[model samples]
Target: MLRVLLRTNALDDRVRKTLVDTLYTQPTNLAIGAITGVLCSLVAASYAPDRIFLELALLLTAIAAARIVMAVMLPRLRNRDARRMELLYEFGAFTYSAVLGVFAAMTVWYQLPATAQLLMVAYAIGYGTGIAARNAGRPSISIGQMILIFTPINVALWNGEDLAHRALAVAIVLLWIGMISITMTVFHTLRDSVAAAETSARLAEKMQHLARTDVVTGLHNRAGLNHYLVEYMSRRRAMPNLALFWLDLDKFKDINDALGHQVGDRVLSEVAQRLRAQAKQEAVIGRFGGDEFILACDVRDRREAETIALAVLADVTRPIRIDDDRLEIACSMGIALQPDDGEDLETLFQGADLALYHAKVNGRNQISFYDPSMSRNLVRRREIEAELRLALQRDELSIFFQPIVDLSTGRIRAFEALVRWFHPVKGELRPDEFIPVAEETGAIITLGNWITAQAARAAAQWPDDVTVAVNLSPLQIKAPGAAMGILNALREARLPAHRLELEITETVLLDHSKQTEDFMAELSAAGVRFALDDFGTGYSSLGYLNKYPFGKIKVDRSFVSGVNAGKKSDAIIRAVSGMASTLDMQIVAEGLETIEQVQAVQAAGCTLGQGYYFSRAVPDYLAGMLLARERERLDGPKRAIA
Candidate 1:
């Protein structure tokens, strides 16, 4: 029964058909050989006597030998067309076909009664036809092949030869066909079902990958990285020496602001490719959303891991291309080693991120190993950030106006607006301490807008002859239509554009030079003037001095303070004054502290100056009174030289 099922099972159509063809062909050939041998022997039985039977036997032997040879050699004939395994199946079919022929011939040689001879003949024919039908789409059906010992039981019983036997024979053939067909159907269904299930599973996996992976850089997102960390923790016992590296790109936002987002995307992809190439062979690298990337590795020790990290940094530090532009991108890397940094996944990640902060703080584009104290610093920074947001809401900030003096006339011309924060509980906070924190936390936008508005309002109450100068943060300039915001505030305050000066640092100009230039050009067109505040500090200032129509160039305190101390300072001031003189630009020397410093700046031909020697930054009300007193003092100077 197993053999029959194996031959007929629909595991594969080709194999089943090959087996059935062999079975059917064998019986057909056998029945033909048997009938021929029997008829020849019986006909010669009367004429040739004993020799007649021998002759028939010899013919039968030759025919059976031919059949056997054909069975064995048939596969070789189709060797080029059939696969090795398939050809083997065909050979087995041929052998079965020959076996049927030999069995029938042997029965004839035995001189069995006509009835038995006929039965053997019929069985052989039925088996041969079944074999032929296995391979061919069409094959001749043999009535003789259908009848056998089983056939007599069915045919003979109906004719009163043996009713019970014939009925059992018919039942067995029907049951066999039914079992084989059902088994074949099951096998076919199983194969199809498994194939479909596998395809669906693969498609689902691809979809999940797309969701987790970054489309431009092919890195995992923050959510994906979080899940990866969780999975790592689950098997962390086995990977006790695992390490995670977190990396963030420096000045990436500048690239987006300068170039376009399209180029930025290309640059990011290039960075990702470089990272993937240089990362440890065993490490899993992923993007932790936007300019951040992550690497999880299994390392033996700190030394081994540092070597990998150093290599990665070196490779990534190389220039990358975004179309026609080449960018020098660098990453600040932080390492957290498992079982050492922290036992749990979240703690380990937090430690690594904190270390990354240290890398950025000290100087970007460097690496730092995770330390226990980093977590403390991280907590403190988070607290600062929260407080900063609160400070903006509670109006804990105050503005101080510093006088801009005329170095030659010794009279104040305008006031520069400076911001000071009082933390209520923390007493006073300097701009250097809190300004950076605000910029990093994106609080600068709100703070800067308020400052601009406040300064404009305060300047409105000042004499028409005096102007207010406010410095703009880089974030503010890049904050989309920032010039419009300034203009709106000035208009709302009813302050003329000429009465409001915007102090821009050399850093802000260089950071987004094109944007800054465009903004300055637009506002300058509207009659608002630009001052190069803290000039002589950055390399781009001298170049910028010629590019835009600046109303004034404030001599950086470094130059102003050391004017009498060094020839270089004096020459710098003299050259700036000379340049302003030639271009008709006003020169304001800041930090004029003494009689000598004031004389030097005035001698350098600077027209405007400001310093503590004149007046420190004071409240709006005090500044108004101070301005009035300064005007009176200038008008009443040298009254009683006594």
Candidate 2:
């Protein structure tokens, strides 16, 4: 039956091996059967005192000794050929049964004393029953042994003339049939159990695979990567050095926003394919969620890792065609080497992520290796982020106002509110030192709202003609209740909506979501004004001016400082000023420090200017005093005429 199952492919190799292992598991049973047979043979020989009886006893003794020896050696030979071992066990069992059968048949054929014949018959029946129970897992061998033991004894009785002998043969035939039936039932039950266990194991393995794999890109997810790392690190001594690479797609959010999520998914899949193509045979690649991929490979040194990263960069940057769009993408990579960067998965991930952040901050579409300084910088940034949260609650935050001057009359038209942090331990901190941290930690929403209310209250105290402009963070603009928050601030301060100007950069327009549109429209309908700050530095589009309610444009400092430098800055400014004029929007030239820059911007048709040449940002009290002085200067000539 076992052979048939194997040849027909009905039983798995593992399951067959498991069944075979059960045959030798009961060494105690083997020892007991051998000793019982030898003792029975000796008793039978002593009673008969015949040549055949003595020879049978000797044969039984030799077989018993040989079986005992085989059982003792089975453990050492277990790792050798499985089929040969199984056959050897079956041969020993069958030969012992055949010898017992011959001993029983000889007693019956010779018409020996009833007591001796009954003793031999009883021993053979008991041994056959033991075989049926103990070796049921392999029914073919066990049942064959039972047949060999019973058939000869039954035949001997049938050939005798005595009616009692014939009756005994009939009863033995019935007993043998019952034992075979029981053996078959037990074998079927064991085989079914093995099959069920094998199926459950296969299902569990498949479920595990699905759990570790990414559904979208068919790559390993974070859990799978962790599993691989754990297994790899366990055998690190025998393997080459490991290099972990963290990769991020540049401006991927812009693609998702401009196109759709469907396109974004396709782009991610294509990127994963490219990564797979470039990866080495020993490399393990995974998606770290959202436009980010992680790769770990065996490398000899940093140079080998660098070579792989460069090849990946080259392949990934190639144009990918999806539908009618030919999208071009770029990725930045960071590498961390084993032992040098970290010894564990979490530390390696952190080091590689820090290096990736550094690459992105310096410039995108580049590669960077982990450095100890990057970790220090990360510690510092974390400290700043924590301190900033407390700074808000402790009232360490204050606002400063920079005056915007009207170029035609050289009079202050408005003031742009800037936030300043007065740290108790570090003195005053610049916005550049902490704003990015605030943005990342989501502290900007509260901080930006506070600035809005403070700026509105200060502007309410200024001359009615002067408007105060406050910059809006992208997060703040997208935040829920942002429009209501701004309106509440104005109402609390008794400031007119038109007297408060909101400044936004091109980043805010990237989403092109209805929420932003409604936020701007809600405030604009309430008589509030909007300005496009840092223009010409980002995704500057004339469509933004038409699509949004922006009434003013501030040229970026880079362009303003380059004015009259015999570069294209002059032409760019002139072009922007012309476009703003045609659209009836005000243009402010920022970062003006010299008369030459002011003159150049004025020549380029800028109506307003802001920078150190005009006045540095000052506190609310100083701004109020400047406004009072400017009011007096304007009225001085009017009083003389009256």
Off by over 4 Å in 2: 1-10, 111-115, 236-240, 249-266, 317-319, 324-332, 360-366, 510-522, 538-549, 559-585, 594-605
lDDT (Cα, tens digit) per residue for candidate 2, span 1-642: 557445424566677677777787867778888888888778878778578798998898898888888777775663756567678888888889999999988888987788888888888988898789778777778888999899999999999998998998899888888988888788778888988999989999999998898888998998988997788777744446789999999989878988999999999999999999999876789998999999988888888889999999999999999999998897898889997999888899998998899888776899999999999888989999889888988999999999999998988999999999999889999899899888877899999999999999999998899999999998998899999999999999999999999999997897587889999999999999999999987698889999999999999988877544445888988999999999999999999999988998999999999999989999999999988888789878999999
- Model 2, poorest ten-residue lDDT window? 1-10
Cα deviation in Å at residue 640, candidate 2?
Answer: 4.0
Model 1 stretches with alpha carbons more than 4 Å out: 1-162, 204-212, 217-243, 250-266, 299-307, 321-325, 330-340, 354-385, 388-393, 511-513, 560-567, 592-607, 636-642
Residue-wise lDDT of candidate 1 within 430-478, one digit each (tens)? 7887787777777888888889899999999988989999988888988
- In lDDT terms, which candidate is top? 2
User: The CA-based lDDT of model 2 is what?
Assistant: 0.88
